[model samples]
Target: MDLAERIESLKAGLLGAIAVGITFTFTVFIHQTLTVSNNWVLPAFPSSFEDLSAWVREAVAFGSGFLFGVTYRYIIRQGENPHLKSGAVMAFGLVRGLAQIESISDRFTSQPWLAFVLLGESAIVFAVAAASIDLAIAWRWIKPAS
Candidate 1:
């Protein structure tokens, strides 16, 4: 890619990452609320909010979002390929959701539904990131790599 294309990708990636990061934050908050309400049996977050682990998780999510943004730009470059877009979103979401499912132990067997929740959350995050990238492209704030 040329320097201009690289810069545009960087800008679009940052925008998408920020958008996904916010979504991640909200998901974490939802998890926290569920924990407090005893509706969720998983310890996805620390008892105290904004702990070191929480920040690390958020950082990872943001980094993943940036990668998704750059890759998605090329995946849908200048075309309306709904199949490819859906596939891309499913790829990311399933990878994350499957990991969550795998992490569940026998002790968490009663809470099998957690896996679906995590899977849905993953899909939502990526979808939001994709939408943000599409918006940036539509607004002419960034151009897809040619």
Candidate 2:
């Protein structure tokens, strides 16, 4: 890719990541509230939201969205329609890949239900992010991959 194309890709990725991060934050907030209020689902958070450690973790999670955006752009060739099927497929692959990691597997061994919920949430968030990015590209709000 040319320098200009690379720059545009970076811009798109950043914008997409910001959009996804905002959406993810809201989703997590709502999920947490409902889970806590209902007492039916117990999510295994590493720390309390108010804790600095939690903030650090959240930052990392948000940053990962940028990588996801970049990857999505790379996967969908230029001029190709970034349709729902592509987005869903990418999200599923990402979620499944992460779930296969030993660290993730070990972390959820004691709380398989929480793992399932988290995995589902991750898939939904990624799928939405992917679709939103594609919409932005289609609308000319962001530059498409080249």
Top-scoring candidate (TM-score): 1
Q: Pick the candidate with the highest lDDT.
A: 1
Model 2 regions more than 4 Å off = 46-48, 78-110
Q: How accurate is candidate 1 locally (lDDT)?
A: 0.81
Model 1, C-alpha of 70: deviation from truth (Å): 0.6
lDDT per residue for candidate 1 within 53-103, as digits (tens), equals 878878888988888888888899858989998898889888876776776
Question: Clash number for every model?
Answer: 0, 0
Model 2 C-alpha lDDT per residue in residues 26-93, reported as the tens digit of each score: 75577677767885433434323677755765675567677777777667754566564466545654
TM-score each candidate. 0.89, 0.73
lDDT of 1 at 1: 64
User: For model 1, how big is the CA root-mean-square deviation?
Assistant: 1.9
